[model samples]
Target: MVHYLYLHGFASSPQSAKAQDLGDRFSRLNLSLNIPDLNQGDFSHLTLTRQIQQVSTLFPPGEAVRLIGSSFGGLTSAWLGEKYPQVERLVLLAPAFGFLEHWLPQIGEVQLRQWQQENYQAVYHYGEKRSLPLHYGFISDVRQYCELQLTRPVPTLILHGIEDRVIPIQASRDYQRDRPWVQLVELDSDHSLGNVLPEIGLAIQSFFSLK
Candidate 1:
């Protein structure tokens, strides 16, 4: 039995619409899907290392898992696929490669300096509709994992939107450029990919060889 896991994006949760959609799709096929809360109750101490550790604890000692992740979670999935051969297959949605490079500039130097000084920055939590304090360690921790180049051929697939302004579609293009094994599916949608869930589901079904 394959252990299917869905890792949500930044500031998102297990209750995300995409997660639910996948959960429902898998459920109809009698497959169990796990969507772990990456935040782990402490948004202030959030880091990629911490999220990876949490995910690591989910599976048994020698078991493999099938991963589907979006944006920040996709970045995490890429790291996992590189480090752990146990990740038998991977699917990334609008992966945030070079995220730090894009993110820091958006926040600007002054804001970054202030965040470093204060140790935390207030960011909007979409689900809760309130600003939460995310620690600078979150940004600092990504530096260690950012340079990861995924060369492993773990049956990978990437679904990116053409009009995605959030992470930029070029990021996916650049990521898939040299890796011929990685299938890049471009959809006429936005960053959320909300309009193409059915297409996304079909792609996943085909990748997993599901009926």
Candidate 2:
């Protein structure tokens, strides 16, 4: 049996709109989509390496797996596909390609400096709807995983919003370039892609050849 999983974006959770929407779709199809909380209930200690390792444990041995990852989780899924041959396919939604490049600036130099000095900074968690302290190690740990090095040829499909100012559609465009195995679909929406979720669902269904 093929294992299906959904990995939510940074500061998001299993109850995210996109995750719930896709879960509902899978439910209607009599299929199950496993969504694990990458935060592990400790947002302050979260790291890219931790998230990747956490998801890796869910992969059943020798089982074909398909992943639907959003934003940061999309980045995680890409790396997983690279390292594990069992990850047969990937559907990335506004995947955070240049995560550090795009995210560090938004945090600002002063904030980053303070975070480095203090080892943690208050980050607004959209999932928890509250501010949580995030450690500097998050940025440092991610330095080792270069998305540019992800040249693994897995059957990948990326759904990115044309108006996404967060990660931007250009990130997906760059990822799809020179990677004949990867396909990108631009949606008319912003970073949240809330407006185009139904369209996204249909595209995912088509990508996986789902009925």
Candidate 3:
């Protein structure tokens, strides 16, 4: 039995369009699809480590598992790939790496400090809530984890839009540089890839069919 774990992006939830689409596909195929809601409780104070741990506990062992993560969830999934050898394949869609190293400068210390203080949660149309306390330390931890802990190579599929403004397509290109097992696919769309879902779905189905 093939089990799938779907992780949503930052400030996103299991109710996103991609997650729902994948869930429908898995239902048709009679495979198990797990999309855990990661935004409950005091998420504002929760660290990335805690978040990943909570997500990890949802999986059942002794079955072939695959992970598909979007945006920040992609980073989480990559960390899981490094930690869990049993995961068969990892799919990252518009993943962000070195987020703090790059995006922090634009946020500025004053706004960041204010954001931390307020602990605000803003809801978006996609059913995700942007939580406060966006820790710079989380970025540092992710960078170190990706650099040192990610020594083992896992079969990975990376799907990104060529015109993604939020995460940029170059990050995916740069990620594929040293990772030979990674397969990169570029779509002619923006960050959402709204026009290319069918193609993305087909590619994922094809990839899973192969050895």
Alpha-carbon local distance difference test for all models: 0.87, 0.92, 0.74
Q: Model 3: clashing residue pairs? A: none
| Higher-scoring candidate on TM-score, 1 or 3 | 1
User: Highest lDDT, which number?
Assistant: 2
- Model 1 TM-score is 0.96
Candidate 1, 147-193: lDDT as tens digits: 44678877789999999988999998888888877899999999899
Q: Give the per-residue lDDT digits (tens) of candidate 3, residues 33-92.
A: 898876654444444676679877866776677888888888788888887777779888
For model 3, the superposed segments whose C-alpha errors exceed 4 Å read: 113-144
Residue 163's lDDT within candidate 3 is 91
Q: Write the per-residue lDDT of candidate 2 for residues 1-211, one digit (tens) a residue.
A: 9989999999999999999999999899888999999989999999988998999999999999999999999999999999999999999999999999998999899888989999989999999999999989998999988777898899999989899999978889988998999999888888888998889889888888888
TM-scores, each model vs. reference: 0.96, 0.98, 0.85
**Winner on lDDT (2 vs 3):** 2
Candidate 3, after superposition: displacement of residue 166 in Å?
1.0
CA deviation > 4 Å runs, candidate 2: none
Can you tell me which runs of candidate 1 are displaced by over 4 Å?
none
How accurate locally is residue 178 in candidate 2, as Cα lDDT from 0 to 100? 85
**How does residue 83 of candidate 1 score in lDDT?**
80
